[model samples]
Target: MSRHAWIDASAGVAGDMLLGALLDAGARLSVVQEAVDAVAGGAVRISEREVRRGGLRAWKADVSALDDQPPARTWREIRTLVTGTAHAVFERLAEAEARVHGVDVAEVHFHEVGALDAIADVVGCCAALEDLGITSVSAGPVAVGSGSVRTRHGVLPVPAPAVTELAKGWQVLAGGDGELATPTGMALLRTWAGVCEPLPPLTLDLVGVGAGGRDPAGRANVVRVLIGTRSSPIASSLAEPAMLLEANIDDLDPRLWPGVLAGLLDLGASDAWLVPILMKKGRPAHTLSVLCPPTLADPLTDRIFRDTSTLGVRRSPRDKTALDRAFVPVKVGTGQITVKIGHRDGVLVQVMPEFEDVAALARSQGRPERVVLQEAVTAARETGLVVGAPMVSVWAGRAER
Candidate 1:
C-alpha cells in the first residue's frame, strides 16, 4: 500500500501551523531544523511548544532569527537559497505575488514572506513531509477568513491579495472573523496538494493537530494532518476514485461504433467498450461504457455526445483497485521483448509479452505469431517469475497454444 498524507484545513492554515502538524505527526525535529538552518544560513532557530485551542491540544511551531533586520529578497535570490520541493513551493508563491502586485516575477520582492522566520516555516515543513516518507499529498477545502488583516503593506482585506491569487482554482470557503489562510499557507497547499477533496477512504495510521496563533471563542483554530494507506475491497493498495459513464444507443450505425469507442479511449477514457444489448420493443442496441478519472469526466462526456448518437449518458463514481504492474525484459530470438507483470500482495499474478513486440518479432524472423508469443512466455517462465493462482494456468495455456 502507498503512504499518503492529507491536510485538513477546515479551520484554516498557515506555514507554522503546517510545520507544527508535521512535527506532531512524528516528523523528526532535528531533520526539520537542519533543513531550515541550511537554507537560512544558520540564521534562524526553531522551537516547539504544546498548545491548546478550543479545548483541543496541539503543537505550535515558532521560528526566530538572530539577525534583527533580515534583508528582503527577490524571487531569484530566494530560489538560490532553497532547493527541491521547498524551491517549488517558493516558485509558486513568487508567481502568485507577482500577479497580485502587477510586477514581474524576477523583480518582485517578498516583504513578509522574505523574512527568515517565514523562510524556515516553508522550507522546514517541506523537509518534515519528506522525512515522513509521504508519497502523495492532498488537502480539504480551505477556509479563508472573512475580515481584514494587517500586513506589511497596511490593513488589507482578509485572504489578502496574494492569498486570493494563490487560491485560484482551488476549493475555498469563508469563515472566522480574521485572516485564516495566509499567503504562505495557500502557497503550500497550491504547490503540494494535487487533489482538493474531502477525506478519502483510508486506514488511518497517524493524526496530527497543529494549533494556530489565535484561540477563537468557539472554534478549534487548528489544521490537521491525516496519514494513512488507501483502503479498497480487493486489497490494501493505492487506489483513486473514478467515474463510470454508460449510454445505451439503439439507432447508431454499426460501422460508426468503432470510431466512437476509439474516440472515447483517445479522449482520456481509462477503458471503453460496447456491449450488445436488446432495448425496448426488441430493438438491437449497444451500451457504450467509458471508465475515466473523475477530473476528465466532463470533457469525455461531451465527446461522447458529439461523437455518437446517444441522447443521454449516465455516470456514477467508482473506486478502482489495480494490481501493481511493471515491465521486465525477456529475450525473443536476437531481439529483446518486454513482459508485463502484475503483482497482488507482493505475489505475481499475471505475466504477458507486449503484443506489438511479439508481432514485430514474428514478421522479422519469418515465424508464426503464436511461435513468437510462446517463446516470449517460455522465456518469462524460465526466469522463475512466479505469480498467484488464478492467472498462472490461464497464461500458461495461452503460451502452449
Candidate 2:
C-alpha cells in the first residue's frame, strides 16, 4: 500500500528538527547519508541522538560542516547539486529570497539556506522520505513564532521576510516567542506538503519526534512526523466522500487542456479529465471534470477558474470506490521499474508496469517504449506479482518512480 506522512509542526519546524523526526520514525541513517553524500560530496556529516524537550524525549539531528570555510553559493550554483524534491524545495526558497531581497533569482546568494549543513538537511529529508516510502505528505498549521532574529542582512522581525514570502497561501501563526519556523522549514513544507490541515485519517504505523535547538519550558520544542497507510477505496465496498467539479470551456486554447488537467492533479485532485460535449446551440467544447476529496474542492475549483477560460464551476457530491493498490520495483535488465499491483480483498487482481518508469528506462537505454514496457511486465510476472497470486505485505521502502 502507498504510505502517507503527516507532519505535526504545530510546535514549530526547522530543517534539522524535521530531519531528526524522520530519523526517529525509522528511516535508515545509512540511506539518508548516502543521498546527502551524493549531493554534498562529503562536505557535511549528520548524526542523531536522543534529546529532551520539555521533559519529552525526541531525536536531535545535528549536521556539521566538514569544511570550515564553505563557499558562499548562489542560487544558480546550488541548483546544480540537487534533484527531485530537494531541488524543488530550494527553488521555492530561492524565489522567496529573491522576492524578499528585491533581486533576481540568479543573483541570490546563500548566507544561510545555501550552506553545507542546510544542504545536508534538505537532501537527508528527501532521502528519508524515499527510504520510508512516503508518497504523499500533509501537515497542520505552522507556527512562525514572535520576536526578532539576527541574520546576515540584519536583525529581522520574527518569521523573517523570506519566510513570510514562502508562507503565502499556507496557514501559519505565532505560536511562541522567537522564530519558530525557519525559511528552509517553510520551503520544505510548502514544497512537499500537499495540504495544510489537521491530522488525517490513516492506519497509524509509526511516530517520530525531532527536537529543536532549545528545550523551552511548558512546551515541546520539536516537530513530529506520523507515518501511516490509508485504505484504498478502490477494492472496498464502502465508498469515500468525494466531489466532482466540472467546467465547460469552448474558448480556451485546445493545446492548454493537458496543462490545465495536470495543474488540477498537482493541486490534489484525485483525477482530472476532459470529455467531448456540445453545449447550447450546438457549440462544440470539452467538459473539464475534476474528481477530488471534498476537502480539496475549493482550491481545485479556484484553480479551474484561474487556469481555464471557465467563468463558473459546477460541483456535486460523489462516492468514490477504487481497488487497493501497491507498488513494487522490478528489474528490467539493468534498469529498475516500479510496477503497480491492484488487488481485491486479499487476492491479486491485476499487475501493470508504471508507464512513466518504463518510458524513462527506455529513454536511457535508447530502446522502444513498447519493448521496455513488455520487458517490465515480463519481469514483474517472473517476480510472482501475477494475477491470482495471493497478495503479500511488502516493505514500505520502495520509492515512487
Candidate 3:
C-alpha cells in the first residue's frame, strides 16, 4: 500500500512543531540531524524532548544557531544552502514572500524565517518525511489565531503578512489568542500538502503530537500528524476532494462554449464539460460544469461569470476518483509514441494509445491513424506489457476493426 501523511492543524502549526511531530512519530533522530547539519553547514543544532501541552503528551523540538547573531539571507543564498525537497520548500517560501512584499524574489530578506533555527526546522522536517517514506502529504484547514504578534518589523497582526500571502488559496480559520500558524508553518504546508481536506480512509500506522511553545487556555497547543496507508482497494489510485462549479446558460452564443471550456482547463480545471438541459418553460439550455481543485473554485467562478451569461454559479464539493495511470513509450515507425495505461488494485485494466501521439505518427509515416494506433497496441502486447486476458481480447477486436 502507498504511504500518506496527514497533518492535523486544528490547533495550528509551526516549523518546530512539525519537526517535533515527525520525530515523535518515529523518524530517526540521527537521520534528521545529519540532514539538518549538512544543509545548515554546521551552523545549527537540533534537540528534542518529550513534553505535555494541555496534558497531551508530545515532543518539542529545539533548534539553535552556533552564532549569536545569524546573518540574514537572500532567496538565492538560502537556495544554495539546501538541496532536493528542502530547496523546493524554500523556493516556494521565497516566491510567496516576494509576491506579498512586491519585491524581486532575490531581494526578499528572510528576517525571522531566515534564522538558523527556522532553517533547521524546515530542513529537519523534510529529512524526517523522507526517512519515513511518506509518498504524499495532506493537511486539514489551517488555524490562524487572532490578536497581534511582535516581529522584527514591529507588531504585526496575527497570521502575519507572509502567512496571509501563503494561505491565499487555502482554507484558514481564526482561533486561539496569539499567532498560531507562522510563516514557516504555512510555507511548509503549502510546499508539502497536495490537498487540504478532512482525513481520508486510512489504516492507522502511527500518530505523532508536536507541542507548540505555549499552552493556551482551554485548548491544546499542539499539532498532530497521522501517518498511514490508505485502506481502500484503490490505495494507489487518485482520489481527492474537488469543487464542482455549474451554471445554466441559455443566451450565450454556441460559438463561445469551446473557448470557455478551453479557458477553464487552462486555468487548472481537472475536467470541464457541457451538458444539454431543459430549463424552465421548456427552453433549451446548457449546463456548464467545471471540476477543479477546491483552491481554484473562486477564481474559476469569477472566470465563469466573465465568460458566460449566467448571473450565478452553483458550487459543490465533490469527491473525484481516478485510476492509477502512467505513460509507457512504444515505437511507431521512427517516432516514439506513449501508451496510456490505467491500473486498478495494482492490475492493469485499460491501455490505449494517446490519440495525439498516434495522429502525429500517422502524419509522419504517411499512414492512416488507425494503422498507427493498431501497430502501437500490437507492440505493447508483444513486449509482454499487456496485463490481462480481457484487455488482449479487446485490443484484438480493435486490431481487426
Query: Estimated TM-score per prediction?
Result: 0.65, 0.63, 0.64
Q: Residues 109-164, candidate 3, lDDT per residue (tens digit)?
A: 99878888889988899889878877667789999898999988788998888889
lDDT of 1 at 385: 50
The regions of model 1 sitting more than 4 angstroms off are 232-401
Backbone clashes per model, in order? 1, 5, 0
Better of 2 and 3 by TM-score: 3
Q: How large is the C-alpha RMSD of every model relative to the true structure?
A: 12.5, 11.4, 12.9
Candidate 3: regions farther than 4 A off = 235-321, 324-401
- Top-scoring candidate (TM-score): 1
Total backbone collisions, model 1: 1
Model 1, TM vs. native: 0.65
Encode model 1's per-residue lDDT on 1-401: one tens digit a residue: 44678899989899999999999999999999999888888999998999999999999998898889988889989988887667767877888888888999987799789989999999999888878876567799999998898877788998789888888778988877799999898888777765587887778898989988899898999999999876653543558798999999999889998888888888889999989999999999999999999999999999989988889999999998777665767677698778887755334668788999999888988889998898998887765455553222222222110
- Stretch of 10 with least lDDT, candidate 3: 392-401
lDDT (Cα, 0-100) at 119 in candidate 3: 91
Of 1 and 2, which scores higher on TM-score? 1
